[model samples]
Target: MTANSLELNPVATIQSPFKSRFGIPRQSGLVPDAIGWIEPHAPWHRAEAWAGIEQYTHLWLIWQVHDRPHQPVSSVRPPRLGGNARLGVFATRSPARPNPLGLSLVRLLAMEHQAGQVRIRVGGLDLLDGTPIIDIKPHIAFTDCPPNSHSGFAQNEPERLRVDWSMLPHDEALRLNDHQRLVITQTLSLDPRPAFHDDPERVYGCPLFEFDVQFRVENGTLFVLGLNPFP
Candidate 1:
């Protein structure tokens, strides 16, 4: 390895409903019902490695930025700024930086050990399915939660667009359970359309869990066209 570089191995893999990046929330902790888990690999699956871990209610996940990790960009157009102005990559949390790493604070729901295999259940996550987890750290409120922090351009949470699932057939709607419904609604509320690409007549398809979510946006409202099982 180079002097400034180091090799790292993924300790776990994330199992999340977000199959693709199209509909994932821009930030973590936005969707409370977006449940997922981290299954440790090989030697990391030992129970002793997770001793006393249940004491913490939340954790910080250090993961890879998947698709964007291989690409490099010096500047980026932030969707929060209407995608009109470009800012230095370091100024914003764009995944196209030199080191494509992502950090998310997730609520720990459970820690299970079955036959020496370990899984960490978490909620309010924004990671995609099969994302590689490099490290996990407990959330320390005393030091991590800094008061009076400025958000810069993103002064407030992204506005949620009103969603209309009326177009979905009764039978198809029944396929989604309560948790799935919340995940879908919460994911759609953020308006997953690309910032620079706003085509009211265009149909967008997002992969959520095992279903292909089809929808369209018109006049600030998102209409669910259909939900088809992933073949």
Candidate 2:
């Protein structure tokens, strides 16, 4: 193993629906409909290397944190400041700096070419299931579109967390489908949690299959009372 000590592996591996990473939403297209897939590995699953990548709509993951745990930080303590502020891990994105490498842009919801393998069904992912794909650039809206990008020092922009679909459960609104009921009502109206972890007598829970919807967030909105569906 010496081609400069080769070992970069993961050509692809994210299949997210975010099975864990506790309430994911740390940033990444902010849940335009959190869904994911990208399983290319093995001879790069050639199909001419996924020619034209479906006329791009967005794609630029370069993931690899495989579940962190390699610590040796440069500075980090940003759970959006609930971790007691202490930035400087290249100004925060902190997966524990020095190369935990994770950058997303997502949203290209289709592309499968099995038989030589190649799948890619992304959508605003925040990465969490398997995560490993170490490169897949494409989002080039004119050199990474930045028509006035500047949020240095993280200028405040948090205010959206109101979701009350009449306290859900008219048979769970007939099992959603209008884009998953508008992405679960805009992901619980953006209260993905993390402003010092707001807690109005907390009660958040999220799992839906055998049911477990019990949410709560008062004032900033997000209240779905009823339906433990047996959990």
Candidate 3:
């Protein structure tokens, strides 16, 4: 088939909590709690076919790079090195590419139909809100899970940032469930930032709900001053 004939139009779009790409996790599986929904176009809304999809733990999402504005290229600068180092586009998960496609393996929560419209509730999405979706596929553990995967050039486990959760108010701490609490703690601990941008004096902020969490890491621990819920 010719290139023009192989072009695939989006069948759906994802509505996610992620309004901006700034704070999204570099990888999807890293944030299993983040939720989103997929709304399929009119032509493909057959509720019966998607029935029992909640029985599965995860689903594979084939989505388009709606946020990518530049032309696709064969090489890119990975964020890991503060975008100073160049690597083959295929080696890194850069959004800019020939196809501008994104593949994410996310947890399926539920499916809802309204007015003949089918929506899929999912978790651990890295895409921004209204991201165009090309297709959906089931994630088979037996076939998709590769136990002996190698990292190749992406070796060297990065060090985690330290966080002091004890400083949080009792009421605020109690508001989060065990899973949310753990995820929040773990995510902050990773200190997801450019490797070369680490500076002791630098402070970072992450918007959570109505608050902006300002923190810094020192001595392998993250220190939280207080919460500033954004307006």
lDDT of each: 0.89, 0.73, 0.74
Q: Could you tell which candidate, 2 or 3, scores higher by lDDT?
A: 3
Candidate 2 lDDT at 12 equals: 76
Error of 1 at 116 (Å): 3.0
Q: Per-residue CA lDDT of candidate 3, range 76-130, in tens? A: 8877666788899989888887887889999988888877567889988777778
| Ranked by lDDT, top first | 1, 3, 2
Q: Give the runs in model 1 whose Cα sits over 4 Å from its true position.
A: none
Model with the higher lDDT, candidate 1 or 2: 1
Please rank every candidate by TM-score, starting with the best: 1, 3, 2
Candidate maximizing TM-score: 1
Model 2: how large is the Cα RMSD against the reference?
15.4
Alpha-carbon deviation at 73 in model 3, angstroms: 3.3
By lDDT, the best candidate is 1
Give per-model TM-scores: 0.95, 0.35, 0.77
Per-residue lDDT tens digits of candidate 2, residues 44-133?
A: 778788899899988898888768596858887776566787877888886776766878888898988867667889887888778888
Relative to the true structure, candidate 1 reaches a TM of 0.95
